[model samples]
Target: MLSPDKVSAHADEDWENAGAGDTIDVERLVAVVRRQWRIVAVCMGIFAILGLVYILTAVPKYTASTSVLIDRGNSQIANQMQASVAAALPIEDDASVLSEVELFKSDSIGLAVVDKLKLLDIPEFTSPARSPISMLRSLLNFRTWFASDDVAADDIDTLRHNAADKIVADMDVDRIGRSYALSISYTSTSPELASKIATSIAEAYLVDKLNSKYDATRRASEWLQERIDELKQKALDSDLAVQKFRTAHGLLSTGGQYQLLSDQQLSELTTQLIGAQADTARARAKYERVKSIIDNKRTDAIVTDVLDNSISNDLRKKYLEASKLEAEISARLGPDHVQAVRLRSEMAEYQRLMFEELNRIAESYQSELQVAQTREKSLQDSVTQASSVTAAAGETQVQLRELERTADTYRNLYQTFLARFQEATQQQSFPITDARIITRAQVPTAPSAPKKPLILALAMALGAAFGGAIGAFREYRDRFFRTGEQVRDVLSLEYIGHVPAIDAKEAGSGNKDPESVRGLQNGNGITNYVVNHPLSAFAETMRSAKIAVDMENTSTRCKVIGVISCLPGEGKSTIAVNLAQLLAMQGSRTLLIDADLRNPGATRAIGRHAEQGILEVLLEGRPLKDVLLLDNKTKLAFLPAVVKRRVPHSSDLLSSSIMVNMLDELKAHFDYIVLDLPPLGPVVDARAISPMLDASLAVIEWGRTSRRVVRTTFAVQPEVMQKCIGVVLNKVDTEKLKLYRSYGSGEYYYNRYSAYYHEA
Candidate 1:
């Protein structure tokens, strides 16, 4: 069972191991950026300077703007006139405003401005119209005799087109929101020219509009005039034809109800026949009244005609006078008197006259009725004859009515044309435009280009981005080991400890003689380093290596520990020697063997001048004690290799049965035998003897050797890798590691516990 601390420690180690693969940590990236800040600053400064230079050298341009008010004028007038005929158009929207804006920037305006200002005469717009690249090519081809310097006609036209296109491109036309106003602007090097061009474009647009309206009015007037003349002639000819037709038929009446001659005769005869019929009816009624008076003897009942007659009234008066006379005479004489008889005779004569009058009146009525009947019959016959003639003339009347209708149409057309013609003439004389210039352009007071501050800020931002990229690249490019964690993680090996770099003055570990220490490289002979500086961080690191080796060994008696390196100058010998001495000081019988026949650094470090050591023992059967050097102070023993003969294959010699036998024999006497072998990179000596040793340890120079080299070596020799105990990250700069908080060993272990240790 493990404690919580132990379990946490194991988990943390596993986490760190997992993180050491291809995955990059954010903290490490930030650290790398911080470490390379000086480079980033330099790059930013350079970019800023370039921006400053451009801001100083860039050309300045002036912009001029003109405002135009565009009303729905012409469209309104057109709509009013064509209301009944034309389709109703939608009110102007954003698209209509944009169309106007495009018109303001169109080539027509450009051409007009060019002509008005004589832009072709100006060098700015016309000279060197060909692009610089094209001109350069033409110049380059000038050495050939047949190379034409004359521009083609089409090319000249194209150049002019490009110039016009440039003018349009430089002009900006923007509608002010939804309002009917446009802001037209142009940019140029010359302020006055820019202003002039802006103003001219606005004026030109107005003139073009007026011209369009005038043309439309002229067309309408011409069409109306021609139509009016044709209508007047047609009306005159129709009226004359109608008059001629009336004269020929003798039916001349100006009103529509008037009839032809035959129709009038028929109407008069019919009226006469109706009068005759009324007379005949009255006469018959009178005759019937007389008959009733005579047959029924009702003399007192008078006829209506007699009552209405003046002669009958007079006759009735006379009869009454006579009867009065008769009565007087009878009273005077009896019967035979002459006077009385005359009176009676007068009365009787009056009565006879009254009867005769009544009879004559009746006869006169009868005769009048007969005459009326004869007249009615004749009139009836005449009416029938006239009706036949009128029917025959009905077709002619239809023809005449058609001619009258045609004449009315012509007259009406003439009146309409005349009215429209007058209107068109008035409009043509005074034309109106839809758009007018609201604000005239003026010469600009200040240049409007090459924004300096904005350019500088952008340059700085770009520089920072590029610098960060460079920093990231540098971090990825560095593939060497920097901490103990890297040795374990990158190479998948156990990490023992990391040895702090020894100062030059304290690094001569095995050189007991002052002269030998001075002669050593950086005075790095650290064979007695643990004994001399027991309390120092370097010595503590060596103790840590010893502990790791002890913990890794499972054998009961002895552990044959082989110290190897992937490359030379990695401090493997120093680590092995110091580790063995540290074990000896702890009362372990340890032997430090310098088994590297090639470049024996340990042999030289201990000041051993013996010409024969492991090589002589293995080849000549020399006893090991004869070449073994023992440290008297720490009682540590080491067998140093002396070069007695140059062997071609050192790895083969190290793998010999004799050397294995010697190592086996020594293993029984010592508690721990540490062998410092040659680096495994240039030769296979370590791999050759790895089977003979119990375990092997690799020494990697911190921040120096590449992890790939070590990992590849182990990969090639699986047996050696299996026998390998782990690695020690040697020659670490402890002070530098403290600054790099991202380094796992430094941040979590060394820096945290640095104050706990005291200096030797």
Candidate 2:
């Protein structure tokens, strides 16, 4: 027993750790699993059966596989031959190998295989077998509703394309790890067909590669031939232009030298003119010196040329001797001596002869100067003529050189293209590919799909997951009181005890006075259960309720306790009848009143035979003693509620001054007054008269009544909740209740104390 404020404070303290509800609780989870295991098992069994059915009905498909090795080196020979005309094939890498795998599964390869194998003729290939699921999908197709009836059927080409697409769709191509080997697999209903298609795919891929290479080489060869012919003609034309230009310009070369004849002549003339100029300068200088000697009569002056002349030297010598002889005769004799006169004449003759020799030398020097000057002038004229011819040829040589360069370029192109054409022809003749089938596809003996065990296992797992989800949802929604701990923790009210549900058969059994039980309308034996079996658990729970009432109202002589619940069907009426009986059986004066004017469950249970009840006493001013029905064995007085019609304002009637005074009068004669009030959730009668009541006992259906509804009921009727002494969990299934037993809860130790209680 606890006051409302103390209970509220205690509830708040319990709620301090309410956030912990969000965390995972292992024991709670185990309890939920234990309670819901049957649901999970049923769901799993259903799924497993479905999986088995699917496996049995599904069509078997055989997958045949073949391996193809991509040998890039196989094409090296062709690559080398066609290197000039075509680019080299790419070397195999991870990406390239994967590209090959994709190519193997390409529509082109599929189409090629289809055509070679004449797949269009085969019905299986043209119109493949559809699975049940596919057929069902076709049946449910929404597009068919909108489609026109005049839609054209597929033609032969379209059928072929469809067959090829089907082949590609069913084909799988995978490259082995980090290798150039590709695994080609095909799935089909027939093993042979699967093997044939897989093998055909590999062969078709190789054939496609070969055809591609051959076509490329053929095209390259034709192009190279056209280029080679064009270049040959261009080479010939360029050579002809070079010769023609050389001839037009008269730029003739000698001895196979590139230099023109006019240029050689200019060079030779320039050298000769330089030598002639030098000779002319020397001759002029000699001629001037000799003339000066002759004119000035410088016989005493020594000239190299004059001195070399024999006559001049002889004449000079004779003159020198004669002068010497003249000088001696003049000095020895007189100036007019005859011998001196002869010497003088001889000297004069010698001088004249020397002068004549000097003149001759001068004339010879003049002749040599004239000859040298003439030669120099002739050489200069030749050089000037050659320079003019060479200058004109130089301008023409520029055009000749350009024509020669063009001829050389065309010739080189022709040779290169000619070589490329040969290589292209060779490549076209000897076509090669990089892919080859290393392992031929073989027919598979076993089906590759619809693995029974794995599918069943997966189905079971899926079912378990779905079941677990449903169980979790149920657990999330299970916000009901299942144990006494829930009542204490959720509502913060003292937990009295749980009343086990009594079946009708068990309630009527072991009763000697059937008429007396019938008169009290105790067919379920719930109203007088404590009188029949005081040692039973149900009767014991009543005692606990009585104890709670007595504890809460220790100061009062008579405790007026109202038995209420949040909702109907929670056994509040049964609880009130049993509690009153237990008090009366224990030698305490007890009065059981059915104050629930709306439903009157207690009146229907134990006072159904009474003609008048609490309603008659209240509205008609009837005496309470006249309407009271007393149990002879327990001496418990029962006040029934008889409603002739609907009572809409039941709460107003229950809270009236007449009702309060009636209860006060009954309390004077009874030690405990138990009133069966209407559930607080649907009516306010319980809360309206709660001010006059000493205490209230809340009866909650175990695992059925929601904790939220009870809390809300109390929240709306705080006065009733404040006077609430304790809560009794009613209508409990003891077997199932064990699953919800938490540690430190009353139910957790129910088994240990169960030996003390027995039904009569």
**Number of the top TM-score candidate:** 2
lDDT of each: 0.76, 0.83
Model 2 lDDT vs. the true structure?
A: 0.83
Number of backbone collisions per candidate: 1, 0
TM-score of each: 0.60, 0.71
Clashing pairs in 2: none
* TM-score of predicted structure 1: 0.60
**How high is the lDDT of residue 76 in model 1?**
61
Q: Which stretches of candidate 2 lie over 4 Å from their true place?
A: 1-23, 80-94, 127-154, 216-426, 509-519
